[model samples]
Target chain A: EDKVVQSPLSLVVHEGDTVTLNCSYEVTNFRSLLWYKQEKKAPTFLFMLTSSGIEKKSGRLSSILDKKELSSILNITATQTGDSAIYLCAHQETSGSRLTFGEGTQLTVNP
Target chain B: AAGVIQSPRHLIKEKRETATLKCYPIPRHDTVYWYQQGPGQDPQFLISFYEKMQSDKGSIPDRFSAQQFSDYHSELNMSSLELGDSALYFCASSRSGNIQYFGAGTRLSVL
Candidate 1:
């Protein structure tokens, strides 16, 4: 069965701290991995990585994929109270567009 | 920029009832996807349609059915609602080989 696992299911840190979230997947035909930050409503697109070793960054958030290890990491620097939300990792297989999501890392940034 | 739109931000229904959730994709998007997120759970892919055709299916229950129309809009029709059916239903749209844009989900509560 294909599955995606995320570590440190929950994390807490004061403002300005940095955090790293990990996601590993086991699937038949790997295509791409995506990162999304979900607030109270919908999950917003962050990054999509199809190639390994190339880091994708936007603002204070960046992510990289390690295809050899079947895993990926999301790094958030200079965290703020506004960054408190669930960070989700999902993957799509080459066969279709269906996404398999990890449990997500709940991040709480205290001021 | 136009984004994916979903209807009935909130819905309450009794067990054994039925519900229909609508989704309007971003203008010109070619694919539509449906997901269900339980309390504190990652969003799970339910189904997807591309060009008005069923492209893929995930862990959707047999009681649930979905379709995309000629205009590229989609609808998820859920029947025989159970307490376990309560979840946040999200509709996402994307162009092939592009990142999906998620709509503000419909929160369904089955009492």
Candidate 2:
């Protein structure tokens, strides 16, 4: 069965700290891995990683995929209170766009 | 244009009643998917319509059904609402090769 698992389901950190959230997926014909951050009603897209050894970055947030290991990691630097949200990782198969998502990691950045 | 739109931002219904949730996919997209998210849980796939056809369904119960119109607008029908069915329902639309855009979900409470 295809599955995605995220570790450290909940985390609390002080502002300016760097945190790493992990996601490992076992999918068939994996096409890409994507990340999302959800704070309110809708979840916003973050990054899509389709290759290993390459990192996708947006400001203080970046993610890398390890296709060899069938895993990915999202790193947030200089975390702020506004970044306190659920970070989700999903795997997309090549055949279809239906995404399989992991149980998100709830991050609390305290000031 | 609006990305994705959903109706009844919140709904409260009594047990044994029926509820209808609506979704208008992104104007240019051809696929619509429904997901349910309980408090502090990952969004679970329910059903999807793509290319004006019923694509697939997840592990949702039989009481839940979905339909898609020729215009790609979709509706999710839940019969005999149960307290366990209370959660936030989200509508998402995506083009064949694009990332999904989600609507502000409707929070349903079964009393």
Candidate 3:
């Protein structure tokens, strides 16, 4: 059974702190891993990592995939109150685009 | 900068009632995927269409049906709804089958 697990289900941090969220998956024929940020109603795409040893970054957010370990980590630097949201990680198999998602990490950045 | 579009942001229905949800993919996107997210649960894959054809399916209930039209828009029809069917239904579009962009989800409440 393919499954994705995220640790530290909920976290609270003061502004300007750095936080790391972890996700590990076990799937057959894994193709890619994706990250999303869900706020009030919708989830917005964040990053998609298909290779190991390479980090994908957007401003203060970055993520890296460790294919050998079947895991990934998302790092948020200089967190702000506006960054508070649920972070989701998903795995997509090579056979199809169907996604298996992880229970998200709820990060509340306090000012 | 176009994004996937969903209609009827909120709907309230009673048990045994039927509801229809619509999704319009981003222009030129060839694949569309549907997901159901229960309260505090990870999004679950329901179904997907590629180029107006049923390409994949997931844990969707038998009471639910979906289709993609020539214009690449899709609809999910659910019948005999139960309390368990209440969830946030999200639509996502991807041009290359890997990275998916999601739309604002439709929230369904069953009483």
DockQ numbers for every candidate? Answer: 0.72, 0.58, 0.74
Question: Best by DockQ, which number?
Answer: 3
lDDT (Cα, tens digit) per residue for candidate 1, span B19-82: 9999999999999999999999999999999999999998999999999999999999999999
User: Looking at model 1 chain B, which ten-residue stretch has the lowest summed lDDT?
Assistant: B92-101
lDDT per residue as tens, model 2, A45-107: 899888656899999999999878889999999999999999999887853467788999999
Q: Which residue pairs show backbone clashes in model 3?
A: none
Q: List residue ranges in candidate 3 displaced over 4 A.
A: none
Model 3, span B1-111: residue lDDT tens: 999999989999999999999999999999999999999999999999999999999999999999999899999999999999999999999987768889999999999
Between the candidate structures 2 and 3, which one is better when assessed by lDDT?
3
Provide the TM-score of the second chain in candidate 3.
0.98
How do the residues B6-88 of candidate 2 rate in per-residue lDDT, one tens digit apiece? 99899999999999999998887989989999988889888888887888788778998889998889999999999999999
Task: Tell me the deviation in Å of residue A2 in model 2.
Answer: 1.0
* Candidate 2 segments whose C-alpha is farther than 4 A from its true place: none
Identify the runs in model 1 with alpha carbons over 4 angstroms from their true place.
Answer: none
Flag the better candidate by TM-score, 2 or 3: 3
